[model samples]
Target: MQFRRTVIALLTLATFGTPATAEGEKAGAFDYYVLALSWSPNWCLREGDARGAPECAEGAARGWGLHGLWPQNERGWPSFCRTNARSPSRSDTAAETDIYGSSGLAWHQWKKHGTCSGLSSAAYYDLAREAYSAVTRPVVFRALDQDIRLPAGVVEEAFLKSNPDLDPDMITVTCKANQIQEVRICLTKDLIPRRCGTDVIRDCTADRALFTPLR
Candidate 1:
């Protein structure tokens, strides 16, 4: 009886190694990476009120905050790959919260995107922070002294100007209604800037998108 129970247990373990790990065997299997940066003011507006958001309140008008570093392929992307699902280690506390601008965002990103990177949680997040550091925020985002609206092309130009190596094809601008929502840039697996496939680009159709200044 004991032997039969043990055999059944072994079969179960073999059938389902681990929920997260089972999917992880293919982690880091991607063609490129997309680093998305959210425009803070617009994000706050979408969420409801800037008065309640930490990134927007108390004079904390951080122009751009990381959305995520997603691993992608030329055709489609993989998600929720495998992971231990453990929390970020002690050393990654700041990057997981402060650098990401929110602990919740950090957690979600790690589970959704970072897990697919095939990197340890700390390493994946550190890579994301590094990717964010590589991007030069466009001058327009530096300080919006007043509310302004500009063509999507103008915004793309700003990014190109700030990053000499970046071409229009490398940056994809997304907007929500009339507000600029996020800016996504393509990069190589090693985090070097690269030209992304046209299909992966999701540009906003708005003729002019509003750029809200820090509150």
Candidate 2:
């Protein structure tokens, strides 16, 4: 009788508690959540003293390096960071570390925060610029023909119109003389725009094809 009681107790403990414990452990393994800033490295630096720092530093510091505005998860873990960094100058070009830090910080932030919400006006402006860039000069754009015909000034207008919440100065457009096919758009936190020759341009051939001339 004693042996049977002990056996039943052991079975109940394993059947009722082990799986829940395992799942809880698995869920708890992830540590933080991330909020991505979309402004270019140049604008990121101009925004503030802390904006250009790597995400790891922001996460560690528990805010955008400003006082008393730290982000916290339900479990109270700090979840966001300013992981972007400026490109190394010619004198110090050998740095091979990630522009941010390890994948661990990003992973942890994502796990904890899930997604960022209720961004400040500055953050929203930065995010809008990123979305505009994604729609216009996406990474996939490079795969298209370099010589593909693109509409003139349409890229600039479209980017600006798409992001109305930003200040006018935040959306600057410029084109390259050598690569007439290229266009670049820049947005800053203070809502200033600075055109750069090296920036990618949006192509509007697909839109032009959708409208046909009537006889």
Candidate 3:
């Protein structure tokens, strides 16, 4: 298991170059978090390779799950810090595999974003899971019961209604080829509602998007 985690860690490094900070410097500490909740049905259907992804498996049918809790700045974000950090803690690896629905996904997010947060692997994952739980999903799922297609604005509004504390600016809907893919919600490090920067608001250029029924 350690060998596999090491391989995954090195592979991630190859993709995102190693950070230049001193060995003793803090890593992954950032301004805010972008809790991205992916719509599983869209991923399973549109991205065929991820068809049998556990997050969207028949028995689970998880409507939306944590894609990642990324560290972001006012302009951009941090990544690939602590070039030598090991894989997520064994405890986090086990718990997050179920929460993230894939061991690789859990490991990748921690390697990419978690290391930069300057938190221990366990604390980082605790925050990630807490962030996931802090945001309620029933409202969106309640509205998406059937196989229906709707404008992207409606989905955003539903989230706002469900989470009354959020403003129109705090959340954004992402779509691919008019299919709703994910909902990006902005929050402070302490998990309070936050407004995303203007530079990174929405993903889809489309005014309308489809919502495939949850599997």
The numbered model that scores best in lDDT is 1
Model 1 segments more than 4 A misplaced: 1-25, 48-51, 84-86, 89-94
* Tens digit per residue, CA lDDT, model 2, 51-94: 44453332232111111111222232323322232322332211
What digit string (tens of lDDT, one per residue) describes model 1 on residues 1-215? 99999999998976555322233446777789999988887788788263465776747767778899988877567788865646685456555656577777788888778888888887888799899989999766766688788877777778889999888888998888788988899999988888876555768878779988876
Please give each candidate's TM-score. 0.81, 0.23, 0.79
Candidates sorted on TM-score, descending: 1, 3, 2
Q: Candidate 1, residue 32: CA error in Å?
A: 0.9
lDDT score for candidate 1 against the true structure: 0.78
TM-score of 2: 0.23
List clash counts for every candidate, in order: 0, 14, 5
> Candidate 1: deviation at residue 133, Å?
0.5
Give the alpha carbon lDDT tens digit for every residue of 1-215 in model 3: 99999999999976555332222235855678889988777777776335555666665665777889887776567787763455676666767866676777888888878888878777888899998888877555645567777777777777888889888888888888778888898889898989986645754656556677666
lDDT of each: 0.78, 0.31, 0.75
Which scores higher on TM-score, 1 or 3? 1
